[model samples]
Target chain A: MVAQSTGADAKNPIQVIERMMKLLDVLSYYHDPVSLKQLALETGLHPSTAHRILAAMGATGFVERGEPGSYQLGIRLLELGNLVKSRINIRDSALPLMQRLHQEIGESVNLGVRQGDEIVYVERTSSGRSSVRVVHLVGARAPLHVTAVGKLFLLEDGLPALREYAKRTGLPGLTPNSLTSLPALSRELDKVRRHGVAFDNEEIEQGLRCIAAPIRDDSGDLVAGLSVSAPAERHSANWAPLVKQTADDISAAIGYVKPDQPAARR
Target chain B: MVAQSTGADAKNPIQVIERMMKLLDVLSYYHDPVSLKQLALETGLHPSTAHRILAAMGATGFVERGEPGSYQLGIRLLELGNLVKSRINIRDSALPLMQRLHQEIGESVNLGVRQGDEIVYVERTSSGRSSVRVVHLVGARAPLHVTAVGKLFLLEDGLPALREYAKRTGLPGLTPNSLTSLPALSRELDKVRRHGVAFDNEEIEQGLRCIAAPIRDDSGDLVAGLSVSAPAERHSANWAPLVKQTADDISAAIGYVKPDQPAARR
Candidate 1:
C-alpha cells in the first residue's frame, strides 16, 4: 500500500484515517516514550485532538500508554507485523544468501525493498565482530536519494519513475557526499543502470560505505536490493565486483533469469 | 491496550471502530495469505462487506494483496511492530538471562507477555543446532490455557481473572495433557501462584515440555513470563529443580524483588 497523507478534503473518510495514521507516524519516530504535549507539537494537532486520537488508538491496542502519561506502539501492532513478515517469502529465501555475503565481505549485509518514497529493510545479517554495530534494523526505512539499496531500486525502476520520485521527494543531502540535486542524481542513476550496481560513498552515514545491486523477480520486475555495508576505510574499489556478483547470485537463487539465459541454466 | 474484541454492538463511533477491529481479528489468525472468501466465512460477514473492508485495509497499508487475490498483513505493520518491540525494555533486559538459561539447559527460550486471551512471544532464542527445527518466530501467539508461559501469565493476573479467562475462552484440549475443565485448571493455577513457577507437560504440543516463571514490575505485578521448552524426553524428575531455579533466576534478573528478605539484606 502507498504511504501518503490524504489532503484536507473534508468529504473524504480517508482524511480521518490519514490523521490517525499521522499519530502513529509521530509515535513511531520516537525511540523512547512520548508525552501528549510532545505529540501535539509534532503532529501540529491541538492537544485535545491528539489526546482523543491517542485514546482511540490505545483502546484498540494500536498505541499503548506506558509509564503513566507516555505512549508507545502496542503489542497488537507487533503481532500484526510478525504475521506480515512471516508471509513475505523473501525473508526466508534470502537469509542464507545474506549470511554468505556477510561471511565473504566480513561486513553487514542488508536486503531492502522500495515502499513509497523510501526503502524499507526486509532482512539484515551482521558479522560477529564486537567492534561493529549495525544501525539498520529489519523494518527501518531510509531515503531513496541517500542509500545504496535505494539507488539500486531507483535505477531498476528506470528513468521516468526515478525522475518523478526525485521530483517528489527532493534529493536532500544526508551527508556531504550525498547527491542533493535532481540532475546529479539522474546522472548517478544512469551510471548505476549501466554498471548494474550502485554505491553509497559515506552518504547515509558519515563513515559507512555500501555497494548494492538490484534483485528481480521471475517477471523481471525489481523486487528488492541486496547490499554489503562496511566502514569506508575497509570498502575499497576492489569490493564492488564482489558485491555485484553476490547480488546476482542471490537474484538467480530467487528465480530471476538473466535476459539471454535458458530457464534450464537455473 | 487490550487485544480482545469487544464484539459488534453499533452504539456510536467507538462501536463502529469495534466492527472494523473485527476485520483485524479475522486477519490475525492466519500467517499465510488468506482469500477474501475465507475472511468473509471466518468473520460471518457478507462477501461484499469483506471485500470493502479488505480494500480499505489494503489502501491504508495495513493489509497487502498477495498473488492471485490473496491477502496478508503488510510490511507497514512490521514497521510499526518493530517500533513496539523496540520500546519493550523487558525483552532486552531479559535476553542475556534467557541466553544463559538456553546455554545451561540446551532448550529453546521464549519471552512473552499477555495480550488479552493469548500470550505473544516478544523474543525467542533457539539452541541453533542442526538437528532441531523449532520454528517459533517472535510475535507468534499461544493460547492461555495450554503453554507454560501462557499459564504463568494467567496465574500472575490472579485466580479470579484466571477463572474468568478460562470461562470466556473455554479450555479445550490442544493435546492429551491440556486441562479441559475450569476446576482442574483453577487448581493448577493455584499451585503455580503458590510455588512461583508453571509447567507444561506436553499440554500444548504432545512431545514438548516447558517450565516458566513470571516477571514482575516494580509494583510486584507480573508484566511478562520467561520459559524454556525442550523435548519431553529431557524432562526427568531430576531436572525439575534445575528448571525452577533457572526460571527464578530470570525472574529476579527482571526486577522481581522478593519481599521476605532479612532486615540486614533489605
Candidate 2:
C-alpha cells in the first residue's frame, strides 16, 4: 500500500477513495466548520466533485454538515478511534523494542503498569545469561515503593502523593536498603523527577538492581515504565541514559509525543 | 447521505469508496489474514477489482498484504484513530445530555475528572432555578474526596486506594457534614460501589449536596463522573437512578460500552 502515494495524489486516485480522504484531511485540518469552496480549494477538487464526495461521506456519518455549504469532521471518526484505542495493545508495540533493548543491554528489559499500589509486570525479555534471577513472571505485582518503575509512578504522583503513599503503606521494608521513611522516599523521588529515571538499589531483593524510565501516552500521561534489571555486580548508573532512550523509543512506538516536540500528523 | 445506503450496496457504491470500505469492514472483522477469494466473496467485488483496490490501499498503508494473496487491516488506521481520539472532547458530547438531565432534574448537572489529587470540573449545565451555589468552574480543582463526582473516582480507584487517599488527604473537612475519617469514607464508598453512584451531602459546601454516577470510556475505564448538585434541603436519594442513567447516556455518547452488552458497529 505504501508504494502508491504518487498514484494516490495523481489527478485520479483509488477511483474515488483518495478524493474522499483528501476531503477528510481538509476537515481534520480545520477546527471550525469549513466551507465547500474552502475544502475544494484546499484539496484541489472541483466544487461539484468535492460536494458530491462530501455528500457521500456525510451519508456514512464520516463528514457532518454544519451550516449551508459547510462541513466538519463527524462523530463516526470518534467511534472508530475509540475502537482503535481499545484494540491497541501496548505490549504489541513494545515487544520488538523490548527485545532490541534486551539484546543491547544483555539484561532483562521489562514493562510494567500500576494496578492499585502495585506495579504489575506485563512484558519482559531476558538476557539469556540466566545468572540473575527474576524471569517468567509475566503477571507478577510488586509494591510501588520497592521497584524502579514503581518510583516513576510515585514521581508522577508528586510529593504530596509520595508522602501519603508512605504514610498509608507504612513504607514496609523488603530490604534493609529500601527507603522506608517519607523523607528518604521523597528524596529518591526528587532524583527520579530530576533525571526522568529511577532505580531500585537492592530494594525489592538482595543482589538485584534495576533502572527505569517512564513510558507515556499521546496525552502525556504516564502509562507504563520500561526497566533494565540486572545483578547488582553487573548494573551501573551509566545505563541510565540508554534505559531512558529505550523507554522513549517504546513511548514513541506506543504513540507518546513529548510535550517539547511537535506531534506528527498523517 | 444516509438515504444513499441502499444504492451503496445494490451493485456499485460511490464509484469505489463503499466497496473499499466493504473490504476494510471485512478486514476489520477478521482477526487474521484474509485471502483474496474471501474478501472478493465477502464484498461482492471481482477478484481483480479487489486485488487492484487492495494494491492501491496497500500503497497507502491502509491495508497490509500478508502471506501471498492474504491481507489484513494496516497500521494507518491506528495513527488516524489516535488523531481522532485526541481531538475528541468529552464536553462536546456531554453538554447536550447534561442539559437534558438538568432539564429533567431541575438541578445543576456537572462533569468532572480526577487531576492528581483533585477532581476538576470540565463541563456543566445548571437548572434554571437559582438555588445552586457552585457554577462556572470549568477549570477549578477540588479535593477528590469532597465532591460527589470525586467519590466516583475514589470508588473507581478501589478500597486500598481509597484508604491511601484518606491517609493522604486526612479526609479534609470543608463543611460540617464532610467525611473526616477512613471508616466513614469506606462505608460511603461501599454504597457508591454497590449502587454505582456517589453523594456529597453538603460536603464541599454547606447547603449544597450532590448525587453522582461514574462515566466510563470505551474500555470501561471511568474517565469522568456526572453529577446533579442542588440545595441540601431539596436533594433526594430517589434521583440516583436518573443520574446513573444520564451518566450512562453520556458514556454511550463518548463511545463507552457496557461490559455485558455487545458493541454496536457500523
Candidate 3:
C-alpha cells in the first residue's frame, strides 16, 4: 500500500522531506532559538515551506516553537544525542587517557570524529584556569579548516577533496590567522601529513591555540582526533610531541599497531 | 496555508505525528539498531505504516536505516542534542563542583535532570576503580523509581503525583530492594522529603548503592540531581552528609541560597 502511494506522489513527498532536512541542518548551527525568517534564509527555503515543515516537526517534539515564529532544537534531541554518544565505545575507552593528558599538561584535551565536512567533539576535558573560553564543548561541531582536529581530517582528504570542501564552506574566516586561501590551507595540510600533528594558532579564536594528532582503529583507519587546547600565551611547542604520543597510545589501545613496528610472531 | 491544510486533514496529520513520536521514543530506548518488526510491534503500528514513516525520517537524517529493516538513531540527533545541552547553563556550572566532589570522595559523580517519566544523565565523573561496569552512561535513561536522584524528583512531586507516577510505571523493580509497591515508594519518599537526601541501596542494580541531593536554581526550583555512586562493599554511611554538602555547594554556585541563611545586605 505504501509503495503504491509513493509511486503516485514520490516527487512531492521527497521534495518536502529534503526541504525539512535542510531546515533542520540550519537549526543545528545555532546555540540559541532561531527565527523562522532566519531559518528559511539559511536553508534557502521560502518562509511558507520552512514554516510548514517546522510545524510538522514541532508536532512531533523534534522542534519547539519559542515565543512566536522562533524555534529551537527540542529536549528530545538531547535525549537522542545522549543515546548516540553512549553507544560510541571509543568515547568511553578514550576518556581516561584524555583525562590523564589534561592532568599532565594542564590544558584542555578533546576527542573529535569527522562527520561530513566537520568535526564533532564526542568528549573533552576542560582546562580549569583559562579565562579565555574555548567553545569546544562536547557535541560541538567545527568546520575542518578552522580547528586542529579538523585539519587532521582535512589532511586525510588529500588535495582534491580538500578543494571541494574549501569551495563548499567558502573558507570562512573566524580570525585573522584563519587560512582562507587554497594555497595556504594546502601547505598547512602538507605539514600535518608529514609530521602526524596539526596546530591551530589563534585560528578559530584569537587567543586560543590547539595541537592535534590522529587516533586510528584496529584497521589503521583514522577514526578520531585527540587535541590539547590552551590559550596562546600558554601554548608551547613542547606540547606537540606529548599530544602526538598520547594520541598514539590511545590508537594502540584501540588495537592499531604502528606501521613501522615489526609484527610479533603468534 | 498550513493552517488551512491542517483544518482540512486535522485528524490524520495529528495521528501521524503521534505515531512518529512514539516510534522515535521507542528507538531511543535501545542503544543498538532495532528492526522494523520489533519497532512495529512495540509501537502498535502496522509494519507498512512504520516503514513509510521511517523512510521519510531517514530522508531527513532523523533515522538511519541499517541492514535492510534495522534502524538506529541518527547523528543529526547527536548534533541537535549537543546544541540543547550547550544551552543549559546548569551543566557547565555543575561540572567543576562535581569534579571537586569526585576528587574528594573517589566515587562516581553523576549529573542528571528529570525529563518526563525518566532521568537523563547529562554529565558524569567515573570512579577509577570498581570494575562493576555501571550502565549509567551519559544520555542513558532510568525510570524515576530506580535511582536515588530520581527519588528526589519524585519526592518533589508530593504524594498525589507520586501515586500517579507509580501507576504509570507499574513500580517496576530492577532488584529485590526496588520499591515495587506504592506504599513502599511513598514511605521512601517521606524519608527523602524530611532529610533532604535520597538513597538507593542496590535498588537499580545489585551490589551498587547511590546517595543523591537536589540541585536548585535561584528561584528555588529543583532543576537537577547530583549523586555519588559506589559498590555496596565500598559504600559508606559517612558519605551521605558529604554528598549532601557537595550538592549544596553546587546549588549555591548556581545561585540557590539556603532558606535558613539571612539575605545578604545589598
Q: Which candidate is the best by lDDT?
A: 3
| Most accurate candidate by TM-score | 2
DockQ of 1: 0.16
Against the reference, the lDDT scores of all candidates come to 0.72, 0.77, 0.79
- Which of the CAPRI classes, incorrect, acceptable, medium or high, describes model 3? incorrect
What TM-score goes with each of the models? 0.39, 0.63, 0.38
Model 1: how far residue A257 lies from native, Å: 26
Q: Is candidate 1 or candidate 2 better by DockQ?
A: 2
List per-model TM-scores for chain B.
Answer: 0.60, 0.75, 0.64
lDDT of 1 by residue, B1-266 (tens): 33233354323334334445566766766666788888777766767766766666666677778675688666567656655654567876678777877777667778888898988899988657525746347999889889888888777677788778877887778898999888888888887877667888898888888777777642356788777777787665454566567556655433343555311110
Considering chain A alone, what is the TM-score of candidate 1? 0.64
Instruction: Give per-residue CA lDDT, model 2, range B147-255, as digits (tens).
Output: 8889888888888888888888788898888888888888988888888899988888888888999988755788998988877788888999999998898887665
Candidate 2 residues A1-266, lDDT tens each?
Answer: 33334332533346576667667777766666899999888877888878888877776556678587999776555554444445556898788888887777788889999998999999988546666556428899899999999999999998888788888889899999998888889899988888989999999988889999999875578999999888898888898999899889877755565655433234
Candidate 3 backbone collisions, by pair: none
How displaced is residue A145 in candidate 3, in Å?
28
DockQ, all candidates in order? 0.16, 0.21, 0.17
Name the runs in model 3 displaced over 4 angstroms: A1-16, A41-49, A91-213, A216-266, B1-17, B91-213, B216-266
Checking candidate 1 for backbone clashes, the offending pairs are none
The Cα RMSD of model 1 versus the native structure comes to 22.0
